[model samples]
Target: MSIKFWRSLPFQTGFSIALGAVLLTLILSIAVYNQTIEKVVTDSNHRISQLISTIERSASIAAYLNNDELALDVTRGLVKNDIVTGVSLRSESGMRIISGSPFNFKEESILHFPLASPFMPDEKTGELFIKPNQQNIDAQAKQMGALLVFTLATHSLMITIFVIFLVQNRLTRHLTDLANTLHKIEPGSAERLQCPTLHRHDEIGLLVRDTNQLLTAVQNTLAGERRLREYTETLEKETRKEAERDPLTNLLNRRAGERAISRALDKADTNNTRCAIMLIDLDRFKPINDTYGHDAGDHTLVTISNRLTDALRKNDIVIRWGGDEFLILVQQGHDDLQISVIADKILATLSVNIDINTSIQESIGASIGISLYPDHGTDPSYLFDLADKAMYHIKRSGRNGYFIHTPSDTA
Candidate 1:
């Protein structure tokens, strides 16, 4: 089954946006709760101080008259308010009025209000103390926090749901269909996508049209390029064969032959073995051209090449070294005896009669010269020169036998 790219990607995009909205809502809710607690505490403290202000006049009068009943009335009345937990009133006349939980009020939390003389405003008469209710303040703060969190969460949930719905129904479904259709299409085929009717004139429809055009262009270009590539490959192979092989005898040419001989010599050096390079020159080849025409001479060389190739092992390399000369590389030759055996075989193979057409028969004998790998030195050019000198030595003396080259042989 084909994997769906659009299904995974677009839905994840929607969820990421919705998740961000929800996380932001949570962070703001925490901050608002903290701020709400502080505001509630501040407002509760302010109300407690306001309560002390209200009873200041009554407490002052009580202290001036030294009345216990009046002080009690002021203290009890102040504590009756919901946010006030405790109250204490002290008079200069030694009268004290106390209300619920006044002993529990801490020094820092106590609210103090000073009472003055009724006639002399500067004269200090008495003081009143009040404690704000902390539990009631915290409860109110918690209630406000819950309401705010609920409102933010509800808004965030609604937005998240709307976003996911839009993505799955409006965006991802279309993209998933498009992806599935594209996956089925081969690159150079006639297949194409049809734009949805609902999404006509939108970005999705434009994309479909553009993609079809691109597919058509690719098919055309690939057809032309494939033909060109095949033609180029055929031409390249023909060119390589022409470079490496002789057209007349179909043997390896001088350049390819030299490389093959050098590689054989290198293998012999690596394996601690020996290789033999034999050079052959037809003793009386010019007479065939002079008597029977150059066409017969060409046929003579081709026949000689076939005979030489058939006489040797398949592992040996034979090369046409231009104008009546040929070179052979024998990689398995172990010593001078093996070299002599191979050279004698070549001389024997070439001594046979040649048919220059059925009416005429001619004999073109050959002189073979041999050189060993390390015996004649390693370089291919140097070995060929030594083998040439050996062939010339046979050509000068008896001109039918073979000679293995030594350092004393000279041109």
Candidate 2:
């Protein structure tokens, strides 16, 4: 099907094992065939040599007596067997007697035997040549080849099937199960694996055990980190709230107010918008403290803080700027009229009669000083100084009401 199937471990391993078995079987079969053929050829050659040896004395006797009839009889006897295609007996002076079909020197093997005299054994008379038939050898080789092909095919098929069965059951199936288990196991979960053969002292079993140990470690690590992160988040929230809020009024402190103003200035610079800073100081607040004690002063301050918070827009920020004074930062999209309206609301809400639990209704006014970004002063410190100066100017003119700071007002 796909190339991935061929590349998988099972296919590759099975193919390799089958191929190796087939190759080994083939090589052995070829070697056996060659050895058998060689033995047959050697034995046949030996028998042919023996036959020549048996007739040698007679040939020697015939050659010594110069008997042509005996030489022809010897030649004809040698050619009677089907393996012997031809026979030739040649005398000392090259007088030759041949029997059967003429010999084909190129295609046939020639065996030579010397004829010796009986009386003087050392005396050589003639040569005998025998050419064995090639058809008999070819017939034997064909039979052997057929048997070899059948034997090799049968053994190769059996060996391949056996190897595939053994390998698939013993190795590939286990590995496939392990892989599937690992894929389904979620990281940081309480999941575990128990292989059937895990108790065995094999590499696969060891791998399974080690993997379970690693998963346990990961799960523990994840749990610990989760707890630590939750604790850290809680502490961070409490720390941030403490740093940003005033203890008495529950309003943002001076540090938080400054941070807020800096953020607003950055955003205003980017958006080409404007912001306003208003400073409010209560009139005649020291007298109430002097008359009603410090506890009463704290109560009045808390009450006034609540009133100021209720009067402002949701986006506006109010901070306790110090004793009897508060600072407000308003970002209303460059609308000075909206800022003035908010300031008026704060003044009206503060002017209401306040009961200090002293059987006397007390009322006080606030002196408000407003500053605009990029119009009054750009920096926080400079803008605060300008607003403070304007507030004092309102007090100098007479207590109560509000003043928008300008360069001419400062001059």
Candidate 3:
């Protein structure tokens, strides 16, 4: 439809064919013109040689009989012939006895004749011989000109016909077909483009085949990218879900706690402050589960979990660490009083009686130990272990309260 659209098509084999045809036509035309000129020049030289022979024969008769009238007449006859440009009759002493035209023969010059004939014999007049005395250089030049012009006309006609065929079949037609096909190919569509038929064994066929192969490869690559995009989206969602979950609680979880703590820690750690880890355990929890129905005890454990979670700061982390134990990660350790105050708050929260729902309401209490990072221990593990040991010591020392682990008490 448009010139720009045709130029963009990958299968532009037709333009190449048209260009090749034009070049070939030019070369052939030149060769034919040169050959025609050569032939005309050769024919002209042969004709001039024959005319010189006829003049020499007539002159030898006149020279033997001493017939001046006949010699002058033969010379005049040669001049009348259009092919002969110059003529003369010479004596043994080299004086011009007779001549045709005002043109003078300079010396014995015989350059135009293909071969110089020494003399001719005449039977009628009984003469010995007469030398060649005419040349036709101008006639040869005229003949070559006429032949060159004819060759040009003939070759030009043939080239014109060939160019017509190339434009009709090779240039305009094929390019139009390729452009239409290219326009039909929509991006990401499943539509298949049909390859053009190859009747001639030429460059066009090779180009068509290569273009088809490239298109097929492009389609397959696009399909693969689409599939990969969907797979990547699914993997990202799963990774985000994994990132938010805590393996132990199966609740809002530890990574969620870490996210909240990391924000608080970012502020606290920058301000040269601290955060606390509380190690908590149900006092006499193992014995109660061992003596009473373990199912009933599990109910009590669930109740204790709810109470502990409810007691902490909104930003705090509550995690179940194996049987009858929990760990609380708290932010708000700007002062030493922060840890003591949170421990007291948690102890007071656990003082209430919990109804396990499987039976009557039961009374329970917990021992909680407080520790601060960079104060109790520099690392998370160190702080957690020290806090756990303190809680254990409190449980051992008759339970139902909280303790801050001191170095002396640990020793």
Candidate 4:
């Protein structure tokens, strides 16, 4: 048998009950047997008296007639009983007869029955002696004791069997089935435990109902908590996004771009790759704002920002480094030549003409400076400084163009 079966509620309870029943039966049987033996033995005197009374008439006639034949018949009749070992008959005329087993008739154990004359009521005839068969008496008592024990044991066994059956049928079976059903149900399930048909309105039914109510309460609580957690996470993500982005352009701010660039550089170093940091400053932003207004300047900045993002790859980092200045990171193992090609694309994209109104238009241009990773430096501060110096060189030379800050340029 499986360990589960042995460990099950019914099995354990049945085993305990069976063992207890056996023990109870044994105890009760012993008590009943002992008591029966003592009771039968204690009543031996009354039994012997009854036996003597039955043979009294026959014994009296034998003694009065002084007849040896009748006396022999009387002794034979009394000795036929298993409790009588021997009997002696004595007449007043000196007639005597001894019969059955030879036993020393003691005054203590001997039963004396006066054999009176059948016709003369007042006359004392003779005496009858009997030796009580002790072994036979003991045997009878033992027989009665054993019978009582057998009856008690049978009664106890039947009761035990019936009780075990009742317990298994009524309690354990239902409980085990309910447990199995509940085990199959998932913790947050819509399905509920069903009450047993026969046990409706009973304790078992009440238990199932209460348990389902608890499960419903738990599921509802879990659902509410889950929704709360998801809402909290979404709010945190949106807040972080807002903090990381430039308010006007929606591009990554300087600090957030730096963090992202640092992470990318770490990965690039592990992979033995390269990166390009490009810094760009607007060429004629102050003139555009002075010519139109702050509204025109804002429109120009927003347009330029969209142009820069449109010109870069998806993985490239674009940041609003400060007012009229942008920081861009290109980290795809691009060589300096490819980096120069990307810079030309950005310059072309920024030199585009923007529509200020239905009739009026604004021209926005930018000067770009670039630095390569691990060629000039690996540090973000060092690379950014080099890119800024390169951008100033482009500003001094002319606007609307790009310059790569080579290690030789530092010389």
Ranking by lDDT: 4, 1, 2, 3
Model 2 scores worst on lDDT over the 10 consecutive residues at 332-341
Best by TM-score: 4
Select the stronger candidate by lDDT from 2 and 3. Answer: 2
Model 2 Cα shift for residue 159 (angstroms): 2.0
TM-score for each predicted model, relative to the true structure:
0.57, 0.68, 0.58, 0.84
Best-performing candidate as measured by lDDT:
4
Taken over the whole model, the C-alpha lDDT of each candidate is 0.84, 0.83, 0.62, 0.86
Task: List, residue by residue over 95-214, the lDDT tens digit for candidate 4.
Answer: 879988776666576777787888897898989888878787788889998888888888888988899999989988899888888888788778788888988889999999998998
lDDT of candidate 3 at residue 178, scale 0 to 100 = 68
Shift of residue 110 alpha carbon in model 2, Å:
9.1
Q: Which stretches of candidate 2 lie over 4 Å from their true place?
A: 1-8, 42-78, 85-135, 142-146, 165-170, 173-186, 189-213, 216-220, 265-275, 284-300, 333-341, 351-365, 373-379
**Which candidate do you rate higher for TM-score, 3 or 4?**
4
Which is the better candidate, 1 or 3, if ranked by lDDT?
1
Q: Candidate 3 vs. truth: CA RMSD?
A: 8.1
| TM-score for candidate 2 | 0.68
| Superposed Cα deviation of residue 46, candidate 3 (Å) | 8.2
